[model samples]
Target: MDNLTHSLVGALLGQAGLKRKTGLAMPTLIIAANIPDIDAIAVLLGGDEHLALRRGITHGPIAMVLLPLLLWGIMLWYDRWQTKRGARPEKRLPVDAKWLLMLAYIGCLSHPLFDWFNSYGIRLLEPFSSQWFYGDTIFIIDIWLWCALIAGVWLSLRGERRGQPSWRVPAITSMAAIILYIFANGLITGRAEQLTGRAVQSQFGIVPAMVVANPVPVQFWKREMLWRDSNHYGQGVFSAPDQVVLDPKIGQHEMSNTFALAELSKDKNAKAFLFWSRMPVLREELREESKVRILSDQRFGNPLVQDRFRVVVPTEQDAK
Candidate 1:
């Protein structure tokens, strides 16, 4: 999930009445919600480092426990700093240490939970294992989620400002609705994957090793289905009740043989990419009288977005 969505969820959590539990609750929640993304600094290292580190340890079991403690300490220090500046203590709600710790954990946990809703995947048990987990239930950036959370927060804040009797109702309702929406999408994605898997086996006589139903923008019932078998990668679209649309132009690609892929994987970039990629496809080409290997993950590849997590390795003959 994007940072804005994460921030909105934090604010909604506050507006839904967590704000009453401690001082600076909103800031604590919002900041903690996005703190796991501190690993995004890996982008500065360039190449596939970002892909390798993005949702790994920072979202895993160890960090999930330690990050909240770190945030709790920061929040405590912030309150002390404000107090030292001569601000009247009575002007702010008391910051309870226990509540601060709880909010920090809540906010931190929200990051990975929302991230797992999309197809990009997350390493929940990282440092222990690097296995990737995908929900395939929502787009990375869903406008519907933005609208739902923003409206809830906005309405709740307005009602609170107006001193209404039940100001938190909107935020609470919105949270429940968002959960249900995610659940519904999960069911849809599962059904679409099942249908697409059966269809691909029937039509192509190949059993896919993995099949994913990636959610498309603005079309909740429609999904772009991608699958991988031993020798090929395939993509199609699924509309409810068995409508499968496979475009010939971008329909499928022959997966490179194991030996060729093994050779390519020896490259440093290829190794990092393969470790991070959940649905990788390798292509070998004879270009400029030498072997050129290109590897990309099918999850983010499309005709428009051709610049995926790609690593191109040229043979010594081409380098000469």
Candidate 2:
């Protein structure tokens, strides 16, 4: 999810019990919550790739617990500063370090958690691990969630007269959107699974070892699906899903030789390799001397989001 989305979600959730009583100041909470992500600015300043470090050190367990404690201390320190300057004191900070820390963890951690759900991955366990956790959920930016959140924000901001009903509009609206997305994705996942299952059965005459389904957004009426062999750490699909062998020329996919079994149909010797039930294809790394040529997805290497993976062909002598 985008930074805006993260801020909005935290703001809306914090607004639930924070309508008036020196509330979490959902707006301020939004800032304090996202402040931990300031490390991202380092990427813009220098061309260094640091997503692994940023997501690792900043979103790790230590920062998750310490963030709220720091914010609560700042709140108390600021009040004393204002009082000393003879300025009228505003409301006392209602939330304690414990509560603030919990809120901060929830808000700050939301970034990596939500990012993981999208095709993009997240480094939830950093320092010891640079492994990215990816979830094949709804796209990072979903239309319905945005519209609902914006509307909720608008509705929550309306001015009310004395004795008028106070609407926690933002909280309610966001909750509704979250609920809808959960079920909507369930249906989407099912449709993707069904499509891939048919393709696998057509080629192999048996269910595929596993299918990873990714929803491609073409437009409102038309939808595109990507099917990858199930590469997962879990039992079901949606783990580390691979790529769909979409014929770049034509978008149509069939259960027969036209596309699904096209390679097998062409190479009689390679027929056994076509079925997902058989051994998965081990991709070859094209090497030049010591250099390798391959797409990032094809390479058996890990690069941070910022670093570009170089492709080089091996030299003649290097092959020997």
Instruction: Report the C-alpha displacement of residue 9, candidate 2, in angstroms.
Output: 0.8
The model with the greatest lDDT is: 1
C-alpha lDDT of residue 30 in model 1: 98
Estimate, for each residue in 1-320, the C-alpha lDDT of model 2 and write its tens digit: 67777777766666554434343446446765576676686566332234223455566556666665676677656556766897633554554545654565566666666666655455566655655564656666666566666666666655222333655755676678786775566566666566556755564444544444443332212123433334311112222133223322211122222432443333322332232111122222544326322212211123443124322222223434
**Residue 274 of candidate 2: its Cα lDDT?**
30
What is the lDDT for 40 in model 2? 82
Clashing pairs in 1: none
Whole-structure CA lDDT of model 2? 0.48
Question: What's the C-alpha lDDT at position 303 in model 1?
Answer: 68
lDDT of 1 by residue, 53-114 (tens): 88999999999999999999999998999888977377579899999999999999999999
Candidate 1, 75: how far from true, in Å? Answer: 0.6
lDDT of each: 0.87, 0.48
